[model samples]
Target: MSAPRLRVAPSPTGDPHVGTAYMSLFNLGFVRRHGGAFVLRIEDTDRARFRADSEQQIYDTLRWLGLTWDEGPDVGGPYAPYRQSERLATYRPFVDRLLADGHAYHCWCSPERLAQMRERQRADKQPTGYDRLCLGKSEAERRALGGFADTPVVRMLIPDDVPLTFTDVIRGEVSAPRPDDQVILKADGFPTYHLAVVVDDHLMQITHVVRGEEWISSTPKHLLLYRWLGLPAPAFAHMPLLRNADKSKISKRKNPAARLTWFVEQGYLPEALLNFLGLLGYSQPDGSEIFDFAQFSADFEWSRVNTVGPVFDLDKLDWLNGHYIRELDLAEFAGRLTAFAGDPAHADVIAAAAPLVQERVATLREGLDMIGFLLVDEASFAVDEAAAAKHLGEAGQEVIAAAVLALQADGEWAHEAIEAALRGALVDGLGLKPRQAFGPVR
Candidate 1:
């Protein structure tokens, strides 16, 4: 069989979501294991919520996590225009075919009318969906009846016997709730996700569709489009959602960690973040919690995926990040610290202090904090007032005077000799405990 093709289509609507990375990891992992192409498609058809800069953030954050795609908007492939917005012309033909075949029809129902319909459905405890108000009506007939819009949106004419069950790569046979007449194309001429995704995946030859379990409900709609358009459907694997401590689905609006950029800004190593994400829904055959992407790809299988939603445990992430941080050599660690600090002038200081904090911090931000005092000039440095009050009393002043005299008298300038002299002066001569002696100086 030809190598499979897969893609992660992320909407550029807001901050690049961690869910995007989660889906990308699985998509790219499967491709890497099976020797296939992994594509990145931008689903930017939602004009109302779309942001121009968000597309670039998606590219940047994914790359930052060390995730790459064989084809994307930035890296052109046989599928040249990878973005949904750019391929508007490509979908029109499919939409026309669906309409011509009686599989879909134009709906002139206005937004307000639909809202009121949903409101009534809620009041009546009914399953809310499109009412098919303008199913067979012309624009003139619908306008005359009122509650009509000037431009009509196309809706799929879902049959009563439309299949509600489909095969999932991970979950075996899964059944979804019966769907209503879903809108396929908006009045603005932009195809909705159902139509655009079906068209793109079929054209791009995506062999597998990997996404969060939240999309399982929408699978029937996509499957219907594939069947109606006479296109082969890709294999579906709906990975479990990442949940919060309370088992609620993680969302960027509720948790900053759900934003991919939050991990970067917090100085998490990409390898660590990738490894953490991998462990969320999968485990290595060896039963290890920590493994890099290469190992993950090598051992990936749809069957091994855990369907239960995994809690977003940050303590595990921090532990993994600390492990990765400690694995770095001193020079490399210092270099990363310098880059993350975004201060070239502090390169030497950070390098000198890297050894002191490399094993002490779980993140570059923490490393910087651990050695922040060393980075500032003496003029700008100020002692913490609370610490000063606790350690700068009369007894502490006496220890400092003795430590100064001992340092001045010692000829050797090495750390060991200086430490010995201070210990002898404060710990022995002054008879103060080590903590008492070191408190003020530190």
Candidate 2:
């Protein structure tokens, strides 16, 4: 078999989503392992939802996560015009061909009509979709309806009630009931996902279609389009959807974790976030969870991928990020902390205090809190209310006083001197236990 060619087509709708990163991880793994090409296509045909700058955000975030595509709108390839919006003219001839061959027909039904049709279908307990009202209308009937000024949307025909079966790389053989004829082209002259993806995948020779499980029901429609167009369909692998702790769909509106930029902004290392995503649906041969991306690509297997959805467990990710943080050399770690801090004023103090909390912080952003006590102005530094309430009683105050006297008399202003003074004053001098002695200071 030829090397698998995979593509991730993200709609330029909003801030790049973590789901986009998830799908891209799997797609990148497959293509990289097989020495194949990974393509990036922009599905911007949804004009109302499209943001002009969103496409760049998608590219930027994915690259930040180290998920690179060989060919994309930013980089031209054998299949030029990678963006669906740019390929508008390309879809017209295909739509015309489908129409001439009786594989699709024009539907002049307005939004109101379709809504009413779906409402009536719901009322009658029937499938909700286009009623194919324009299928066999005579010229006079169409003229009476609105003449050509209506600019009807094009709907592809679903031949018969046959089961559409496809072997999924991750889910094994899957079959779904053939769906109703779907709109291939909108009245605005833009092709729907079903039509655009089919054409682009076929033309780009995408050997594998790696996407979210939400698209499973729609796969049969895509399969039908490929059949009608006489184009070979790519292998399908629907990765399990990422869900919140409550088992609900992860949404940007409801969950900040759904936004990929949030992770980056939160100071999550790209490698660590990618590693977290890698383990969500796929795991290593040894069942380890901390491998880097290169190691992951080396051992990626479709058979090992899980069908059951994985939770976007932030705690687990924190633990993983901490592991990566500790693994970094001190210099690199300090450099990373500096970049994440994004404040020049804190640079020197952070550098000096880096080693103190290098072993404590999970994310670089957490460095601010871990070392804030050192760099924050004494006037502005307030004891955490919760900690103070728990530890700032009479005994805690005595412990603090004893440590201060010890440090005041100590001639050397060095690490060991400070440590010994603190221990002598608190741990050895005070009857309190180590945690008790340090509670107030901590």
Candidate 3:
């Protein structure tokens, strides 16, 4: 068999979503396993909602996770113009051909008329869709209708008697009733997602269409377009959507876990984040969760993917991150924490304190809090009131005073020497136990 070509098409509308990374992980894993080509296509057709800076954020975030693509807008490939906005001319020709062949018609219905149509449908308890009022109108008649704009939008014709059926790699054989005639091209002359995606996927030679299960309803619409255009459809695999603890679909507006940048900013290791996402709807054959990205790519299989939605548990992610944090060597761990610290003034202190708190922190951001006392000015440093109240009473002050005297006399300031001095002053010199003596000074 020939090598497959898979692509992840993300819309640059807002903050890069965790769902985008989830889909990319699976697509990249599949491509790596088969030695196939992975592509990144920017679906920036929604001009009204698009943000200019969002495109670069998507690229940066994906690369941070080490999910590199073979072809993208940044690096030109066999298929140049990876962005949909750049390929506008390519879609117009296909739309014109469909119109000329009678497979689609111009829709001249005004906004008011369409709104009233939906209102009437709601009142009559009928399915809400375009009534196809202008489906049979001619060119001259459409031009005579001065109530609307200069030109009409294009809509694909859906056969009422034809039942649509397609087998999904994850959902198995699925069937749906014939859908209403969908608008393929908007009034603004921009093709809708249904038309644009079908055209671009065929042109890009994408062998598989892997996306979230939310797109399953629109699969039939896409299938009809492939048939109308006389183009072979690619294989479809709709993965389960990520859910919150409450079982609601994950949304960036409501859930922080939905944003990819949230994890990065929170100091989550890229390897750990990717490993956690990989196990959401898929698992290893050995049922281990502490594997690296390369191991995941080697063991990834479509048959092992679960169809049920997976919950985005924050606590579970923290546990996974803690495991990865502990596995790093001392030098590498100190380097990662130092980068997160973002302060050269504390370089010597951070290198000294990192090994002391390596096992106590799950994230590098958490390390900042754990060692805050060592970095702050003496005037700014303050002990926790509750902890001081519990351990630093009048009697506790004497133990700390003795610890200070012992440390001042120590010849060496090394870790072992400091440790031995504290132990002699607190545990041996004083009759009090180690916990009791250290509690006051700690």
lDDT of 1: 0.92
The number of the candidate with the highest lDDT is 1
Q: Compared to the true structure, candidate 1 yields what TM-score?
A: 0.92
TM-score, predicted candidate 3 vs. hidden true structure: 0.88
Clash count list over all predictions: 0, 0, 0
Q: Predict model 2's lDDT versus the native.
A: 0.86
Q: Which candidate is the best by TM-score?
A: 1
- Model 2 steric clash pairs: none
Per-residue accuracy of model 1 over 1-442 as CA lDDT, tens digit each: 5798999999999999999999999999989988999999999999999999999999999998889999999999998799898999999999999999999999988888999999999999999998888888778888898788889999999999989999999999999988899898999999999899999999998999998888899999999898888889999989999999999999988999999989989999999999999999788999998788999999888899999999999999999999999999999999999999998999998999899889988889999888888888999999888988899889778877888899889378988898898888889897888999888777
Q: What TM-score does candidate 2 get on C-alpha atoms?
A: 0.90
Residue 369 lDDT in candidate 3: 78
By TM-score, the better pick of 1 and 2 is 1
lDDT of 1 at 251: 95
Estimate, for each residue in 120-219, the C-alpha lDDT of model 2 and write its tens digit. 9999999787677788875458758642437788888877764588788889888876688889999899999989999889988888898888888899
Looking at model 2, which ten-residue stretch has the lowest summed lDDT?
A: 140-149
RMSD of each: 2.6, 2.9, 3.6
